[model samples]
Target chain A: MSEHGVRIQLDRVTKQYPRQPEPAVDNVSLDIPAGELVVFVGPSGCGKTTTMKMINRLIEPTSGEITIGGENVLALEPNELRTRIGYVIQQIGLFPHMTVRDNIAVVPRLLGWDKARITRRVDELLELVGLDPSAFRDRLPKQLSGGQQQRVGVARALAADPPVMLMDEPFGATDPITRDKLQNEFLRLQKELRKTIIFVTHDFDEAVKLGDRIAVLAEQSHVAQYDTPGRILAAPANDYVEGFVGSAAAIKQLGLMHVGMLTGLAELSATSGLPTVRSRENARDALDIMLRAGTSHVVVLDEQGDPRGVIGFEDIAGLLREEVSRVGQDA
Target chain B: MSVKTLDTAYQVTPSRWSRRNLTVPIGLIAAVAVLWLWVSSLNLDSIEARVLNAEAVRRAVVDHILLAVSATLLVVAIAVPLGIMLTRRWAKPLVPVVMALANIGQAVPALGLLVLLALWFGIGFKIALIALVVTAVLPVLRNTVVGIQQVDQSLVEAARGMGMRASRILRLVELPLAVPVMLAGLRTTIVIAVGVATVATFVNAGGLGDIIVAGIKLQRTPVLITGGVLTAVIALGLDWLGGLAERLLRPKGV
Candidate 1:
């Protein structure tokens, strides 16, 4: 499984619900890398959800192909394919009758895992999502708070350890504070598991916080732009992508293109004195200084306060310029 | 949440039964006493003898309660599946006709139904059982379908999103959520059957109706009152008990 890469690609996928005059998802294609957290974001009625649902055949494509782990999903039984892909939805639909532990064990039970292994997996997953099994196990869904239930929902989705996960607004139901906690917890989980993920949400902030690559879906399910978060913010493909990012394109670009990427470049190595800040300094500040310095990019200093890399003006200017013209049109 | 509802490991809340269990039966006995007093004050010559002798009419009451329960259990077992089947998206279109059949079953003169059964199958307990079962299906079937249909769509979506199989989601999430509605239907069906069962005794079935029928024959008020009191108690008791069971079995915390 490790050697076999999981890359999700949608080649001209189209979905038109019967009796509905317009297509929910237009012909669109996307390439998402293995072990990356990619997000598809758009307004409520957009086809972002339709695109995600096609991967495992929850909604069959009217035309085009979808492949997971290099295998065409249509070639496999839908139920069999779904079992290999994790799905999480907005309501955090925990089984009301099931205990927290049993709820988390849903997929593993479906897979027919032995009791001992399944129990261990449930406990491990409960702990990963920040719920103590000692306190939470055996408790029914109604006993849990909203945030806690969402954690269980995630634990359940990840139970089978599927190579890819589909999340549709998994945190949309929670309060801002809890949503942030869940988002961060998910980010940490993804870091450790590195499963290829396709997360759908309308929240731009959530998309920025969680996505490795961000695909902005417009009305009719068109892929306005699909690029790394930093690249998209720095360089939007069209006016739709620009408006979707909000008018603060420069600030948003700085939010993603950190000093780390600039420091990685070979040209940035010659400058030893780096822009020094606290360990907690914002990526925005590092970017702001790089822009003011008129270089392609700047270096990131360490705890000892040393120069890391020399950033060129292109690092800051290139993508921002591409997005700049479109930003006004959207505004 | 009851302490019993929770495991021994933790506490939830007091069960509603703790106090009511003590209060309800005691209250019923008081009502029985009030009825006895009211009747004794009447000085009705036949009342005492009719009740004390365990008149033949009182026999019908016991018979009816048993019929209602047995019929109810059978209907639940049968209708749940049928109801669930009817609720499937592809099968949903069939619901109207099935509902109409259930409605017709209920609309038939319950006595005529038994008479038909008696004429066809011979006069006895079996004929009455057939009539009662026919009447019971309307509530059970209607409730089952409604309960299944009422399951939260988002929960089903979430279950699917987690890659759960269709059958698994139906069994665990959909069924549990639909339980309250199903039980509501079950209760209504049982109550109706309990009332109907007494009338079944006219067809040679033994029940509270037997006491009522025998009381009228013997011109005995005691026999009639005793049978009526017990019949009422049984109806109310089963209704309360069914309600409690519904509350107890409902997916805890939901």
Candidate 2:
């Protein structure tokens, strides 16, 4: 199996329903590079979902060309094309009557994979999704918790190991705590799989956390700004995008930066009484520790929990200023 | 925590011979024994004896069971596929028309339908069987359609999204999910078929109805009582079997 993802190109894709005054998605074009997770962020009914669905032909484009791995999507049979692309939705629709193993085996079985291969693949997927194959395989969907069910839904989508994946609000239905956990697990999985993924969601924070690149969309599937999370948070493209970025843009940007990014840290001896944060922890976590402890500095610890250096409030502020200036230079 | 409790509630009790499962059959047997004892107590006249003989009663009971079983099987065969076809995207327009025709079949009185079929075709077991199917088909057909329709559309979409063709979705997702409702409809059809088969005797198709009719014409209380009690027992017995089948056939975790 090829672990590398292939590029997906949507060339002026448009979706027009019958008798509608305007198309749902109007001439939307995007170039999603192989092995990158791109988030389509917009308000509800803004056609972001419609655009993502068009990539898999769940909602066919009225007039446009979509090519995956340089192959024309429209020319291929829709079912065959879908089998080659992974898809996950908000509801986590695991068939209620099917066992978890059976649900995940659906695509493999459809491809006419042999019994031994499908059984092995199903177990492997359950393990990949952080489920215990021995415990969860025979259980039906109703027996699992909501988060577990959603994990199975993801595993089922990834069953045939499609190079490209489409996820629409995959974590939207869970509570904030579970959604956070699932997002982290998904991020870890994506890191290993490196699939070309187009994720659609309205949650800007989620887009920031998981997307390698974010495409902030407006009405009619118009791309307002498409850039890395750091760039978008530092300098929004227009007023609408700025409005989406909302307040505390600097703080949000800090969430994306690590403590290691702040150079020239004071000696650990000088900040012995300060709160502590791991070097891998983001700058935002460091900031949170400082704010809660009412201290101006925090000690950054390495993997062994030994304090290697100290970071202060001024250092974070200085880093943000430099980032903003860099973005301005790029503009 | 709540899900665990719900899961435990669905666990099957270890014993298959639970009291709840035995109640129907035991009560039905008791009713049969009481009827037997009462009928045996009567000192019957010759006409009553002729109709109440063991050989005649056995033949009639067998005919009654055969009529009900065969008619219900035919209804399932005819109605299930037709219902599946009607719910399909291309055949959606034909739904109301077919439902209307099914409604007409049920709307006609059972006796009237049997007599008309006998008038049009010659009177026999075949005419009686046709009447039983027409009278009992509506519930199963309606159930199958509604059952498939009520399945969550999102599940169907998910199946399609995973590359399942329409036929595969129907077999693996739609039909299995629809089983509970379809089985309920089948149970109703079975009861209706048993009740309608009694009227098969009106078209000269042999059944328990013969005893009842003979008792009525001969003016014999023992014969009438025997016919009435036996028919009621058969209806109850068949209904109990239908209930068991409903439980057994329903897809688990639904």
Candidate 3:
């Protein structure tokens, strides 16, 4: 295996459970680049989870190879390999008997981190996940709400600061409002961390919102199409890929752009009373703000919280028009 | 939400001297006091004639305590580990077999089991101890297996996925979650041991049962009451202690 900036590579991977006729995952290959979040989206029993679990060797592949950071994953001991990769699941299985601090400290402690470092890391993670260390550190999992527990689950997985993370519907259990809030927070966190992540979800919308590239999987874990969310939405490879893209592919394409990415900022002087959106917010959010304010333009704030530019209704409409025509040209 | 309301409800219940909290301890003390007065009111001459004097009662109680405690400790040492082992993959096939053996141990009457052991090992302290331990192992063993098995599989999976070794998972996850139910099993075993050890005196192991047997043979009512009261009090006291241990040892907010 040759090392590359690309973090994980799967070559012709296949998994066949005993007594089952067809393979759960068959002859699937993927390359996940470093510091990018790639989502594997598909319907029920599509082998999306089976493929993700193979990366951690939770479910070993019957054939083919996987390499992480240029080293063959199968060569490392399963437990040792797992320690180097973070994993979060939908159940948010925090150890019920452990305090939040202890739960977060699990991986670091297993890796033989000293007490002082583990303590610092645990508090850092609780804060990172938007949990107050003082209030939540000593509390058991049962004491926290479903959303809070999931946050702790994410923190616990991040404890050792592994370079790679595997998340399987980590936000699937919460109510829609909480789920949206968690997704937003998780996206913001991912921006700073930049770890290579393989996120598994059945929701194509979530893939568009979070994925740097989306791998639309079908039965047998076959990659129906693997491309950037914008490209997939603008030009799905075939009917199967288009079906998974959902009906509003043009609208989903707008979600891929931030307000900061839009060029030709109109004069901010004219938008003084208009609603404001953050530069880091999606173009869809900027459009929503403009619509709700009943204004032609909204002020876009940069990272420093200062107004950097203005995005008007025309910019959003222009972006959508470009997406529609691009798809038309590709067809 | 519901969790917030539950927290407030838990807080409203006072910690010290609450009726719910003090009921067991208070009841124990009152019962012991009444037992003492009744025993003291009995005719000393009749009790002495049946060999049920204070010194005899003291010796019998001591013997009974030793028998029950020793048997309980031995059972715990064997059964808990065996139960945990049974839950593991290697031992899974053996679980049904071992549980069936435990079922047979309990199915046999206590007196019959003791007599059977005596026939094999001869009527003595060793045979009596073996019988009591065998009879009492089932509850603790069954409870331990059930407790560990009932731990959420997701928690175990999460532990494994986090790179925790099997031993670490057992110590940090499985065992801790299993404590409450395991303690319930232990309490049952200890209480059973205390009651069953009285029959140990049949093989001349020397316990509260000696007085009861002597009283029955001699037709002495006072002696019988004294023996029964002493045995019952000890059982009650040990049971209360077990309850306290269970509460104190339980993980918070379980």
Which candidate comes out best when scored by DockQ? 2
Interface RMSD of each: 1.7, 0.7, 1.0
- Which window of ten consecutive residues has the lowest lDDT sum in model 2 chain B? B5-14
Please tell me how candidate 2 rates in CAPRI terms.
medium
TM-score of 1: 0.83
Q: What tens-digit string does per-residue lDDT give for candidate 2 at A26-116?
A: 9988999999999999999999999988888888899999999999999999999999889999998888888999999999999999999
- The better candidate by DockQ, 2 or 3, is 2
Candidates in descending lDDT order: 2, 3, 1
- RMSD of model 3 against the true structure: 5.5
Off by over 4 Å in 3: A1-6, A259-281, A286-317, A324-331, B1-26, B44-48
Interface C-alpha root-mean-square deviation of candidate 3? 1.0
Judge candidate 1 at residue B236 and give its lDDT: 76
Better of 1 and 3 by TM-score: 3
Write down the C-alpha DockQ for each prediction. Answer: 0.47, 0.68, 0.59
Worst 10 residues of 2 chain A by lDDT: A265-274
- Choose 1 or 2, whichever is better by TM-score: 2
Q: What DockQ was computed for model 2?
A: 0.68
- Model 3 chain B: which ten-residue window has the lowest total lDDT? B5-14
Could you give candidate 1's per-residue lDDT for residues B140-175 as a string of tens digits? 787777776667788887677666777878888888
